[model samples]
Target: MNPARFLLPLSLLAAVACSSDASKKDPVAEARFENEKRIGDENITEKQERDATFVVDVASDGQLEVELGRLAQQQSTTPAVKDFGQRMATQHAEISQALGVLAEQKGIVLPAGLGAEQQKTRQELAALTGAAFDKKYLELMVDDHANDVDAFDDMSEDAYDGDIRGFAAKYLPRLKEHLELAKQVQDQVEAAK
Candidate 1:
């Protein structure tokens, strides 16, 4: 029974396992990367390119919002938070579907899931529960909706495509409402602490 021989093999095996795990491909991420690259490569006008990028970015956000909302519903004990979560899940899902249709019409390939940063946010939120989850989730919703409102506002006013502009205008009011609701819920969550 040679101790060095056993230890060496075990360490080598562990290293190999870790390397394999690290190298494993996430198909959704690969598809998203390829779609982005293809968008850049396509022979299109700058405005069209910008529109495509907007669609992809919004699609990713919508997917992340839907997932986070579902996570909140599952983890939060508070009724208001849970209700907000359900609203997010439902509304974002609808938004994603509409964006998908628009992307297809524009010959753009949107990502199938969350972007890297969004995935990180989802992972962080998934690790929290109860009051911590409620606070953090509300904070995220407030921040996200605020940013969304700004982006949508700009697009609604400045988009090169009429359809895109219309879509942005259509959603801006709802996003603003979501932001206000998020702020109210956040205050409630904080006051209860």
Candidate 2:
């Protein structure tokens, strides 16, 4: 055989070998390598970011709502305030339990307590008494429930996982109900103030 023919066959064999090696790469390792290269370019996976944010935020809000509801139950003079507070405590406790179970199933870690802003709000509510406590508490509820409704609505529509999306959808209507009631209660408190 001519020298050129011999070289061409060798080159073809090398190309095939290289391609097979590339095909043999571990998919998981390759993905990690690609992800590592993206570190400085906002490269954290969306699933990771979403899960982290959801767990922390949901835990913090649940803790804050439960604590505030208990405070309302303890300190309010008005029957309506007391009832609302008790209802909040009861409902949010259930929500927290459900969230905890879901987070556990998803292997997500959650914070033990409220975030800074929520803690500050809780501390402020703790310091108030009588009509001041009732007014501030109702106002906070209206605001908080408004935020909750928005967050839950977004999750219901946008979550990538079916379980999470379903959870958000199931609770969104209840959140809306709480917001409407909170608004009415807030208006009532304002009128009396």
Candidate 3:
């Protein structure tokens, strides 16, 4: 019933409301709010989002490698290149299956097929044949495997989820081996040219 007591409580409520409004105006806070809203899960942390993104990206890359490997197998003239392509197709297929299981367990939805850039790369390779196809395919394999190795290595060390980190660590050795083999095959292809 005291006027001063009521005014004090009203002032505190107004300050709290103003602080909430200020947070809504903050760019970082607003971005976080938007992300949470988009995802429809306020409990999903940044680290969780990053882990899910990694899964999706790796899945997409695996799909691309499989497609490219099949193309190489069919188009390459060199025997060694063909063998390399076979190895890529076989090994990446196995990797993709394992990644698919992981993704399913994590509730992350992977892309159904190649992304736009991957589709472009596939189209470019699809347009070539014989030695030209072999050259371009080997070059792409080398570049892709190099990047895959680095990304897997980083994820193996830095992933927020223990399962994701373990998955990366498990595949990193194979990825390194693939990169080395790709380089060797690429050298053979270039040397013959």
Number of backbone collisions per candidate: 0, 0, 0
| Most lDDT-accurate candidate | 1
Which RMSD does model 3 reach against the true structure?
7.4
lDDT of 1 by residue, 1-193 (tens): 9999999999999999999899787889999999988887673567777877788888988998899999999999999999999999999999989988888888889997787899899999999999989988998999889989999999999887999999999999999999999999898888888
Q: Would you list the rank order by TM-score, best first? A: 3, 2, 1
Alpha-carbon local distance difference test for all models = 0.90, 0.85, 0.89
lDDT value, residue 110 of candidate 1: 90
lDDT tens readout by residue for model 3, 1-193: 7899999989999999999987758788889989879776634577788888889888888888889889988898899988888888889889999999998998889899899999999999999999989888988888888899988999999888999999999999999999999999988888888
lDDT of 3 at 76: 84
By summed lDDT, which 10 consecutive residues of candidate 2 come out lowest?
Answer: 40-49
What TM-score, computed on C-alpha atoms, does each candidate reach? 0.76, 0.77, 0.77
Mark the regions of model 3 whose C-alpha exceeds 4 Å error after superposition.
1-44
Better of 2 and 3 by lDDT: 3
